[model samples]
Structures are given as structure tokens and as C-alpha cells.
Target: MTALLDLVLDAHGGLRRWQDARTVHAEGSIGGHLWSLRGQEGILATTDATVDVQQQRLVFGDFTGPGLRGLFTPDRVAVERPDGEVVAERNAPRAAFAGQGPDTPWDRLHALYFAGYALWNYLTAPYLLTRPGVVVEELEPWREADEDWRRLHVTFPETLATHSTEQVFYYDTAGLLRRHDYAPDVLGGTPAAHFSEHHVRASGLVFPTHRFVVPVQEDGRAASEPVLITIDLTDISVT
Candidate 1:
């Protein structure tokens, strides 16, 4: 399991090399329109964010307006409204931000990314390598990677029910994640989908600078027609 974890890390640019680094930084634009929750008018929005990894903190300023800010730390999360009023706040366990156990694998790593990418930049494959009980099931080739590449799929254990959905990660020859896919578990439940691309290396690590996610429609049809939200990360720092 440890060796397997090492392979995963090496695929993402080596855990040791990433850990020894003091910080990582990134800059980019995030812009997309949201399908109105009520199916009314689409809301177009954009944001500019900076992630400071050493302190495990993030600062985001919405580009669409003034004073929209969000800050995240190891122990707490806070978001500020456009008017500068704190709109929401929460406390979380410190370990939640830390990496997983030695027995963890790619499936758990995918889960971590799915569950936490909305809140933190603490994801790096090494954390998943240590988590226990996560099952990694190899999937047969399902799709072509591109005009010149091939793709592989892997699954995680079901945490919800027998019909509960499992995380699916798509990787290329170099073992970097090129895409992620998952379906809904409950009948009539909205299917969840997430896709990431535009990978680039900065500060000793490979990272996806742009990503988009949407929930499948209630009718079990296609996911949300218009993207609900798109995140653009910039000024990312790992320390």
C-alpha cells in the first residue's frame, strides 16, 4: 500500500519534493454563468483568488463586484458578503485538513478532492495514501484520453448505500488526473459531475488551475445545462 501511494505521489510530482518546498503560488481567471436554482435567469459571475499553502489559508475576491471575500484556515472557515458582512462561518477538526493514513489510496484521494476542493487547497495525492479502508478498484478502459493518449479509471468504496455512488478518476500515461466522473445514488437524486483541466506546474507541484462542476438534473437527464459555478484560482502559494 505504501509503495502504491508512492506511485501516486510520483505521478503528481513526488510527495517528498512537494513537502520540502516552502510554498506554491498560482494566478488565473475564473469566469462562468450559473443556472438559476429556480430555473429562472442565469447568473454570470467571476472571481480572483489567492491560496497561501504554508498557513493553510485562502483569500478570494470576487471579480464581479467589490468586497466579496472568503478566508479559510485549518480550524475555521469564513465568508464575507459583498457588503463586507460575514455571511457564514464554521469550525472544523484540525485533522480534517491533514493528510490521510499510510494505507490510504487513490480512491480515498479522489473523495478528499471531491469533498474538500470547494473549501481548501490542502489536496495533494500523498494525503490519500495514508487513509485506511478506502478501496481502489481498477476500471477497464472506457474512453480515449485524446487524439494521442489513453485513459484509465479507478473507483472508491461506496459510503452511502449499495446503490451509493463511487468516485471515478481518469488518469493518463503519466498518471495525472485528467477528469473525474460520478453518478447519483438515490432515485430522482441529482447526479454529480466534476471536470478539471488546464494542468500546469508551479512551485514544484502540478496543479489544476481551472475546474468546473455541475449536478445532474432532477429528471436524470443531463447535468445542469449552464454551469452552476466556475472557480478560477490565482496567486496560489504552497509553503
Candidate 2:
């Protein structure tokens, strides 16, 4: 299992290389018209962040023209603004973030990406056991020509909401997650939904470089709410 885990890590960018460093910085754009974030436009802002795993500290500065400053660790979550006014504060165990839920698409997307990108060590590190009741399955090789990609599927055993029955994750030859598929939590029900994204290796970390959210709509028309959201990362560096 440890060797297999190493394969997975190497497939990403090498665990040894990433774990060797205590802090990493990333600049990226998150949430916009693709996700139909009202009043947000392309490149809503650029962000600079530092994560210190040993100290369990995160501090990020946003240049999106005056907004939130955030710090998150296993024990606490704090937020402030450009004016140095703390806006929110919370102290809770990290486990609280992993409860079963009646989730919306937004919920699943956020939970998956946030957990996957920021805390992959917690999920895949050999020391920590996999979440209970969450069965992990290894899939056969599959190819998508349009995207010029091949994948290994990782299936989740649990459902998302009452209806979210299936979870499928795709990794490239390198083991970085490229897509997520969610299906109805029922027998022979609605089709699966696909969330496809791209990742860039910045600061020895693979973060979402591009993302598109696709809803399985019956009418083939745009969703009442934005069915698709895309984020493009730029100017990433660690200080």
C-alpha cells in the first residue's frame, strides 16, 4: 500500500519533493461568470498564499481590489479584510469539515477540490486511515481522445446526497486528478455529471489551472443557475 501510495504521489509531482518544503505559494483566479458568480468577472483577482504544513498555518493575500484575507489551519479559521478588520473567526476540529451531507453540486465541487488540492496528504498519506465507509476502487485504463488524455478511475463507495449514488475520479498518467464524475444514488436513474478541470504544477503543488463544470441537463439549454464554472491560475509564486 505504501508503494502504491508512492506511485500515486509520483503520478502527481513526487511526494518527496512536495513534502520536503514547508511552505508553498500559489496565485490563481477562483469563482466567476463560468460559475455565474454575480458581479464577478474574468480574473476576479490574483492571490498569493503561503501554507506551512508543519506549523499548520495558512495566510493569503488577495489583490482582487480589496476583499477577504484568510487563514486556515487544523484548529482555526480566520478571515479579515484589506482594512485590517477581522470579519469572521471559527475554531473547530478539522473533522467537522467531513460530515455526510445533503449536498448540492456546489457543495460537492468545493469539498472535493478544497480537500483534494489543499489537504491531499491528509487523505492519501499512509499514516492516516481512509475515511470510514468510503470505499476506494481502482479502475481500468480509459481514454478520451478529444482531451488527449488517458485515465485511471477512482470510485467512491458512498453517495453524495439521497440521489448522488456514484463518484468517479480520473487521474492522468501522472496521477493528478483531471476530472470527477457524480451519478444519481439510485439504480438505473439519472445520468452521471462530469466536472472536468486542468491542473498546473506551481510551487511544487498541483493546483487547478483550468476548470469547467458540466451539468447533465435534459433540455440541453443553459442552466437557470450557471452550470459551468472555470478558473484560470496565473502569476503563482511562493515568498
Best by lDDT: 1
Query: Whole-model Cα lDDT per candidate?
Result: 0.46, 0.44
The global Cα lDDT (0 to 1) of model 2 is: 0.44
Model 1, span 78-105: residue lDDT tens: 5668766776655652333245432233
| 1-239: candidate 2 lDDT, tens digit per residue | 33344455665556565555566555565553432332233323454565553344556564223566665554555566877776766555233334434332232223222322333222222111133344455665555544433333333333212223345555565655666554433212434343435655655555555655455567522233444444455654432
Which ranges of candidate 1 are over 4 A from the true structure?
Answer: 2-6, 21-25, 31-69, 73-76, 80-135, 145-165, 183-189, 214-225, 233-235
Model 1 score (lDDT):
0.46
Residue pairs with clashing backbones, model 2? 11-174, 34-228, 34-229, 163-185, 165-184, 165-185
Q: Lowest lDDT 10-mer window, candidate 1? A: 106-115
Root-mean-square deviation per candidate: 9.9, 7.8
